[model samples]
Target: MIRIKRIYEQLGDDDGYRILIDRLWPRGVSKENAHVDLWLKEIAPSTELRKWFGHDPEKWKEFGERYRKELSEEEEKEDLRRIKDLEKEHENVTLLYAGKDEVHTHALVLLEMINKKSS
Candidate 1:
């Protein structure tokens, strides 16, 4: 199963195979404290798209669609495949993001894509 979590949350043993999905490192977090097994920066939304979204609730739907398109690009295919591979290997794969608005974050969009692909 794949789960989305905030990078600032406390680490737990159940959060198997934590993957940091943000293009940039969180402002206050350190590598040691992150407890991330992998950092898939490439899977994140493009800088332009991120800037456009700005975590605005009004743009959430459009942001997800745009980000999904980004994920489907040729260069990003490998990253998606890698995530699928990790899903098969781990019982619980947690996707960690730094965004304060969890509902509007790229991680949620990515999680939906991953789930759709897996199903």
Candidate 2:
């Protein structure tokens, strides 16, 4: 199974590789503070897409679709392929993002897409 959560969430008892998915460095989080196994910035949506959406709640649905498109376009499929390898070894994989709004963030869309694909 795979899971998604914000980096701010408690990490204890979370037993899987922790990967951060934001392109830019998260707000005030230090590298030491974030117990991340991988920071897959390469899988994040492009800068133009991020700026265009600007975390606007109104654009969330569209942003999700666009972000998913960008993910495929960015050749991040390789990472997905790699994650599958990890899944074979581990029971869960948590994709961590730093977005404040839990509902409208790209991470949710990505989690949906990834889980759907894995299924």
Candidate 3:
């Protein structure tokens, strides 16, 4: 199974194979504390798109659309495939992100895409 959690959340044994999906490292979170198995920054939305969205609820729909288009690139496809591979190899995979607005984050869009593809 795949799960999404905030990077700042307390680490748990159930958070198997944690992967950090943010383009930028969250401020004040050290590597040791993060306990992340992989930092797949490439899977994150483009900086341009991120800045434009600015976590505004109004732009969420368009943000998802633009982010989906961004993920269609070859490099992003490879990264997404890697995530799928991890899910198969591990009992559970947790995607970690630093965004404050969980509902409007790229990680949510990425999760939807991944789950949609799997289904």
Candidate 4:
């Protein structure tokens, strides 16, 4: 199973194989506290796309499309494979992100992509 979670939330046992999916390290979060099993920065939306979206809800749809396009590249394909491998190895795989708006973040889009591919 795939799940989305905010990195700032308290770590829980059910959040198996936590993977940090943001391109940049979240400010003020210590590496030791993150409890992340993997840091797949390569799968994150490109810096340019991230800047363009600017976490604006109005741009969410476009951002998801643009980010999904980015994820279609060869390198991102490998990253998705890695995520799939983790999902197979663990009962639950949580894609962790730092954004405050969980519903509109790239993690949500990525989760949808993963589910689509798995199905």
Candidate 5:
């Protein structure tokens, strides 16, 4: 199963094979405290797309579309495949993100894609 959680949240026992998916390290979170099994910054949205979205609810739909397009490009295929591989290796793969807006974050879009592909 795939799960998404804010990196700032307390680590959970079931957060198996945690992967940090943010382009930048989360503010104030040290490497030791992150409990991340892998850091896939390459799978994150491009800096240009991130800055353009700016966590605005109004831009959420377009942001998801743009980010999905970015993830579909040739350069990102390897990282996308890695995520799928990890899901098969681990029972519960938790994707960590630093965004404050839980509902509108890129993790949600990524999760949708991963699950859709698996189905």
Candidate 6:
């Protein structure tokens, strides 16, 4: 399963392989504090798409679709391929993001996509 978690959340045994999906490094979080196995900047939404969405509720649905499209591209697909390989190699995969609005962030959309592909 793919679980979405915030970078500030404490690391635990349950989080088998923590992967940060944000294109840019999170503020106030040192690399050592992140406790992530991998930082897949390639998997994040394109800069243009991310800026356009801006976390506005009205643009959320469209943002989800667009992000998925961005994910399906050749470059992002390579990242997805790596993630899938890791999922098969690990017990669990934790997707880490820095967004304060966890429920409405790109990580949730990435989790949904991962779940769909896995199922």
For candidate 2, the lDDT comes to: 0.82
Per-residue lDDT for 59-89 in model 4, tens only? Answer: 9888989998998898888888888999899
lDDT of 3 by residue, 8-104 (tens): 9899888889999999999999998899999999889989999998889999999999999998898988888889999999979999999888778
Estimated TM-score for each candidate: 0.95, 0.91, 0.96, 0.96, 0.95, 0.93
lDDT winner between candidates 4 and 5: 5
What are the lDDT scores of the predictions, listed in order? 0.89, 0.82, 0.91, 0.90, 0.91, 0.87
TM-score of 4: 0.96
Per model, state how many residue pairs clash: 0, 0, 0, 0, 0, 0
Give the alpha carbon lDDT tens digit for every residue of 1-119 in model 1.
78999999999889999999999999899898899999999899999999998889999989989999998898787787788899789988899999898678899889888877777
Candidate 3 wrongly placed segments (more than 4 Å) = none
Worst 10 residues of 1 by lDDT: 74-83
lDDT, candidate 5, 4-64, per-residue tens: 9999999999999999999999999999989999999989999999999999999999999
Tens digits of per-residue lDDT for model 6, 21-80: 999999999998789899998789889998999989899999999999988888776788
What ranges in model 5 sit over 4 Å off? none
User: How far off is residue 59 in model 4, in Å?
Assistant: 1.1
Off by over 4 Å in 6: none
Q: Which 10-residue window of candidate 4 scores lowest in summed lDDT?
A: 110-119
Q: Model 1, residue 64: displacement in angstroms?
A: 1.0
Cα deviation of 110, candidate 5, in Å:
0.5
After TM-score superposition, the amount by which residue 79's alpha carbon in candidate 6 deviates from its true location, in angstroms, is 1.4
Clashes in candidate 4: how many?
A: 0
